[model samples]
Target: YPAAPQRFSCFGFDDVNAALAAMRFIHASTPPTELYLRVYQLESRQLPRRSELRPPVRSSPCDCGFVGNQDDEDENFLAIARAMEEIVDDRVDCYWLIRCFVNQFKHKFGDSIPHL
Candidate 1:
């Protein structure tokens, strides 16, 4: 038999300091294994300075056409590139970060994490 799925919700903040404070509190209260982190940013008009030149616009409309803002699409691509860069950054120690998070959890909640 499969185990039951667990679910929980925590406060989300847009401000960096507030978000970090919330994370610290949550880490101290909950087991790191049970914590789920979700990061997102609101869409803004600002775009990266290194975007490529826009593609030539089609003169005549075709049966199949893309109906969307080209600039927005470019911005989305830039965002994806930035995320990939972070994922591959040599200085980012993912395992150490996870251990630190888990240690914080253990420091407050003890060795065993309560199952929900």
Candidate 2:
């Protein structure tokens, strides 16, 4: 993670041993807000389609097709985050979080193109 105020509770590692280090950082008395376990190759292969995931429209109720109303859309995301936090100890799944981030990016800037 970064440092101090900018330090993130979430972590990403390419191997199992690094992930084990992260586990030790978490204390039973005061666990992190969330944890994420990711295999870069696997997630790269299963990237979510940009068109299928878009940001919630705060202005127009029907602009975003995922939910009928804006309030419901916000609630849904909060619920998902809460669920992820609850399962941090059991399993750290970063797929959904990464997908959501990509979707938000694409929603603002059309399709994403990788650059070497």
Candidate 3:
């Protein structure tokens, strides 16, 4: 949360490129190369480990007929999830669902998480 562009919002901000841009901007640095390194480490952990960033390194068969990397269960899950979470009407949105999920479990998480 270092030098984040402050915001006051009750409306949805997730799934918007604007929010991503703001984040990228906040962590931006010109000639200060150190920022990029920190940013990479932060972002790597932000989603998943570096290994998970790429597809499975190797796939081998075992006793279960087929055993391999199932899939990247990180953002990929939420990508499909958000699309499917859309309702037929305006009663609920992906944003609300994500907010609800974070609210429900954020407390259980450690202090690393700032807010929902």
Candidate 4:
């Protein structure tokens, strides 16, 4: 059978912050009892000039170890990585919030959505 016609709804925003605010609103509408929802935020950035100036070196494991532990730079990067991980762990709810929004749209539209 021919694939059912799909209807898509797009809410364009001037910037990411506005989109995030809308996501939070949708997340708030989700039922409190629901759990295990998944969401993700994919971000990208241009290479920084400082990084370009640094010498290329093999990456070391995040754990404290003697290998590649030749300088303070390694320790600094490890600390930064740990801090970033903590931030991501805390923001996991943001993903769920966005998921809730998508689910709501799906439910409201029913068969109109097949692959959001």
Candidate 5:
């Protein structure tokens, strides 16, 4: 299993272990606000920004397309996130990791990518 934040909590036996591991990682690091377990599911992926997961427009056709792309992005982010979670401990916080990733992305896709 990947070592990221969790969601769909309250699963059967297997999930408890995942959550326990994740909690251990989170506990050691500086805690954040509104950064729920589900979000950890996201952080585990090593994404640059949380806003990218939010929707720009609600109840629209374009929303669907955006969702599909976001899912793919999320999956990729999770891979790196999970890997980092495995090694990183109290010294680093998820915020710094997220900001660093996001800034780097902004730098690379500057002027070309939309506000992400």
Candidate 6:
């Protein structure tokens, strides 16, 4: 069967800052309990370079263990993997999980996102 048609409203702005401002205004006026913002770039431009005169450094031949132990990092990653496995085992929809994560991220970092 053909996919169901999707309808969405699109707004254009001269720059990202303008778009973000519009979004903030809309969000404040009609504050939805749940909302997700997805921004897409219509055009791309090469950024101007400031300075470039550094040569690549070569690695030493001797084996040196400069890096510290990563057991804690590894355990943390393993714990996350286990939790994800459990969620999958519960048959949670992947799209729902992604949407939940995106909403959480927006709630946590929405204000700071424009800086990034």
RMSD in angstroms, all models? 19.9, 14.7, 13.0, 19.5, 13.4, 16.9
Please list all clashing residue pairs in model 3, or write none if there are none. none
For candidate 1, the 10 contiguous residues with the lowest summed lDDT are 3-12
lDDT by residue (tens digit), candidate 1, 28-100: 4532211212122211322222244233222322222223355433333333333344464421233234334
Error of 2 at 12 (Å): 16
Error of 6 at 101 (Å): 0.6
The whole-model lDDT of each prediction reads 0.32, 0.37, 0.33, 0.33, 0.40, 0.30
- Residue 96 displacement (Å), model 6: 0.8
The residue-by-residue lDDT of candidate 6 on 3-76, one tens digit each, is: 22111112222243254346442233421111112121112221112253121122332322222223322222
Clashing pairs in 6: none
Question: Model 5 — which ten-residue stretch has the worst lDDT?
Answer: 58-67
Could you tell me every candidate's TM-score relative to the true structure?
0.21, 0.25, 0.27, 0.20, 0.32, 0.23
Q: What C-alpha lDDT does candidate 6 achieve relative to the native structure?
A: 0.30
76: Cα error in model 3, Å: 7.4
Estimate the overall C-alpha local distance difference test score of candidate 4.
0.33
Off by over 4 Å in 4: 1-90, 114-116
Which residue pairs collide in model 1, if any? none
- Give lDDT tens digits, candidate 4, residues 36-71: 111122122221233333322334545333222224
Shift of residue 65 alpha carbon in model 4, Å: 48
The residue ranges of model 1 lying beyond 4 angstroms of the native Cα positions read: 1-67, 89-116
Q: Candidate 2 has which clashing residue pairs, if any?
A: none
